[model samples]
Target chain A: MDEFGIIATYFAPLAGDGAFGLKDDAALLPARPGQDLVITTDTITEGVDFFAFDPSADIARKALRVNLSDLAAKGAAPAHYLLNLSLPHTITPDWLAGFAAGLAQDQQEFGISLLGGDTGATDGPLTIAVTAFGFVPQGKMVRRNGARIGDAVYVTGTIGDSGGGLAIFKREKHTLNDADRNALIARYRVPQPPVGFAEGLRAIAHASVDVSDGLIADLGHVASASGVRLVVEGERVPLSQPLRTLWGDHALSRAVAAGDDYQIAFTAPPGLEGPFTQIGRVEAGEGVGLIVDGKAVNVARPGYRHF
Target chain B: MDEFGIIATYFAPLAGDGAFGLKDDAALLPARPGQDLVITTDTITEGVDFFAFDPSADIARKALRVNLSDLAAKGAAPAHYLLNLSLPHTITPDWLAGFAAGLAQDQQEFGISLLGGDTGATDGPLTIAVTAFGFVPQGKMVRRNGARIGDAVYVTGTIGDSGGGLAIFKREKHTLNDADRNALIARYRVPQPPVGFAEGLRAIAHASVDVSDGLIADLGHVASASGVRLVVEGERVPLSQPLRTLWGDHALSRAVAAGDDYQIAFTAPPGLEGPFTQIGRVEAGEGVGLIVDGKAVNVARPGYRHF
Candidate 1:
């Protein structure tokens, strides 16, 4: 597909969110009566985060979806976005068409729009960076620094499916049959980001962040910001069957350490509760720890880092 | 240097525009007492735009500045920006340190702060893309479609120095000394964008755009947008002494035809005046033309296209 066609096919659906979506030089996000705007951007590269032989549509969907996950952390609804895509020379027209179609489908599903983007042919590896825009009430955007002592930490969706999925794809030499393997493989390709899940918790969550950098690492950010120790209970740590089968007892540990989860890990005061799984709680401190069987685990390394 | 230092030195100064600047998580721009917000983003890449081996500090500064130039075109000033950087492993620490220092310096100069950014290592070439934010009064943002018939076309600063300089640098045979050559190289390497010039015309110019693409090509965008013919006087085109001395008689012509000037070229009513060069005037109906010796001359191959 041509560039415009690809954009029209894929991004137009998402542009439905913007009052002046992709048609203008900039998206016209009408301020919600008495609210302010919140914006953020994230870029993902092939070799640094994924592989070249990746499923293009799935990857494209995941790229834009994670940005939404970031907004969800702020308790903001999907609005509009600017997507800048740098594609490798080897990428074909059909691939771009398919990728855009997938991205369009995600946009329609998430109720966001593609306002504008810069696309170019590159000799380097594939890269996609999306800058998302969302709006919330004047004082409602959640942040890492909002967690308080005695707050309970919650997460949407089972953690580490993405990481475990990767193992399943890599370790085909193991005991996974075709159907089980494909399901897990799909998980690796496209993360079912808890956009709705996070949205539901917004009414109850006091502070939140998307688990992009893995549970331990991202939770550490919230703890450091809020000046509290997030003591995650090992027993409450969510896990998928594939993850358990792939890494055995180390499954939950891998989930905590694995990056690119894009699930929402949030916090609320001890007495408050809502649409999330309680995996941890906050204590008066300045670091994060993992608790197992009433004993704190000696966790030195937190998780994966981009740098 | 590492990433932090580069941002500190070159980009920190230019984070704001004599106002809120980049001090907050997001720029707290006062929207005309009661107005909506308009935002946009643009990113540049090596190979696609410039070479990586070139002085990276200069590259970092221009990458950040050019994106801000887009905001200026909208009659908006810098607030905050999201930087998405893709780097090849080949970039040395010394190179990156200098780059970050340049970014920090510019951040201070431009009066913006780094709200957030995504950084990653790529097997691909070095790429830097920034999405800058700015706010406009309810109906005060100037757009490309605002040009009107009989409006005067003005250009700030000189053109061709940048494009001509690049041409001179690429020459296999050259005679200029380092100092002379450095001046020419500076135009291509570290363009002094007329961000200040934009503010001066904010109240006067009806339609404007930064001359990132050549003047003719950029003006073509306005012409197409406003549904008018933009006739630009070739001789009135500005040219630096270095460009004139380096290229002689064809200097202005080359500047008019060449792109990537980064100067502001805009249209306003004939009676409306400012400290701008009257390069041409907007005419009635649909195409862009170049005037030389009072006659229409063909302006071939408009500007640079990334695709």
Candidate 2:
């Protein structure tokens, strides 16, 4: 099908009120009385982000969820998104259908809707860019530079599961059972961001950041921006059971350096309770440090580098 | 340079207040008391959108202005944008500098700022996706479905100049002077959308659309959505002096069917005064039609198509 045909057949139905049924060039977002809009954009490429053999539905979900993770870290409630897709000629109608289905499923689950988007042809590998919009109360967006001295560092969910999944795809030999294997793979394919915790995080956290890069590298961003030092207790870093079984003793090291965790790593005053683990504390100095046992672990390569 | 380095060097300086110095994953846009946000996105691929030999600055501007045109057509004031870029390994640092310079220049001209974006490595051609945010008074955004019967069709600026430019790049024989040739090429490379006219157009237009696809194709969207017929006088379609020199008598036909004009086209009450030309009228019918010298002109191909 042509671009118009593809949009009409698979995407128009997914568009919501402000999208004008995907017939207009722009979409309208009505102003909220006391809310500030949080906007984030991310683009995922074919080989770099996902294998060509991966399900189209999963690919679509990954593109959306990655941006959603950013909003969650910023304490925003996602409301709408725009999708831009550059497809190679090899893409089939079935693939487009599956991709739209993925978006539809996520929109229903997350309470977000499609606003508007652009679709074009490219000779390159398929690329999907999603721009998401969310809302937070005015002046309440949790920022990276807000971390203060004495603030306790915490992280939501587990870290390194997605990295472990990628390792398995890269031919890592493991005796993991099918369920465990599938769980890890699913984590890589579709991120389960703590979107429900956005309001709470904004209310309590002194500073916040999503762990997209390695835990060390992302915490370093918070540290540099806030001008405070973040020291992590290495053993306190959460790792999935399947990932623990896969890597055993070396899991912590790998997890600390591996990227694509998509979990919120934040800081707040001590003695708080929530669905997070207290992993470290902020200090007066700068930079991020990880303590394993009695010595500091040397991080040669902090995270993935795109060049 | 790595992705982070590239961002810090070239993009961070372009960020504005809500961007948080590009340290955060997401950007915040504080709400305007009585304005509704208008959002639009467009992706441009290397070969499809522009020749690789084109200046990187021009490519960057083109990527931004196309989306800006959509907002202008919707009568929204441009405010901020998110940029997503997938670069091949062959890109040089100089090219990136030029690209950022291009964005910097346009950001100043359009009164917009960079928010946050993603950069990734791709083995394929360069692809840029820009999501622009703009604002209009609450419930005042012109819609494609608001065209009324008996409304007059009007278009801002001349048409087919960009198409003429593309033809020249494709080695189409033309005896035009260097200045004229350069003028056409410039229009193709960087669109000068009628942004300043947005407020006035929104106040007057019954329905509006930007001419990206051929005039017939884009107007057809308005007709289909608004359930009316748009009739264009072929001779009345605006043609630039340089385009007239290039295509002679054939310019009108080519101009009406050419895409990428990035000009606003709207339907409003007859006898209205403005900087736009009255090209046609809306009728109680469906689809779009072209009339030339009292006879109907058949258009086999309506506009540019990507598949």
Best by TM-score: 2
Over the stretch A124-180, how does candidate 1's per-residue lDDT look in tens digits? Answer: 878899887776666666767788787899887778877777776566337766666
lDDT for position B67 in model 1: 74
Task: Name the lDDT of candidate 2.
Answer: 0.92
- Per-candidate local distance difference test: 0.72, 0.92
Model 1 interface CAPRI class: acceptable
Worst 10 residues of 1 chain A by lDDT: A17-26
Off by over 4 Å in 2: none
Q: How good is the docking of model 2, by CAPRI class?
A: high
lDDT of 2 by residue, B63-107 (tens): 999999999999999999999999999899999999999999999
lDDT digits (tens) for residues B1-307 of candidate 1: 4433444454454444311222212222222344545566667778656776688788888787777777777677666677788877677778877877777778778776666666677777888888776666667777787898889898888888778768875792287666656787787777676666545666888888778778887888789778888998888887777787777777766787777777788898775556568888888877788878888888677677555
* Per-model TM-score on C-alpha atoms: 0.90, 0.98
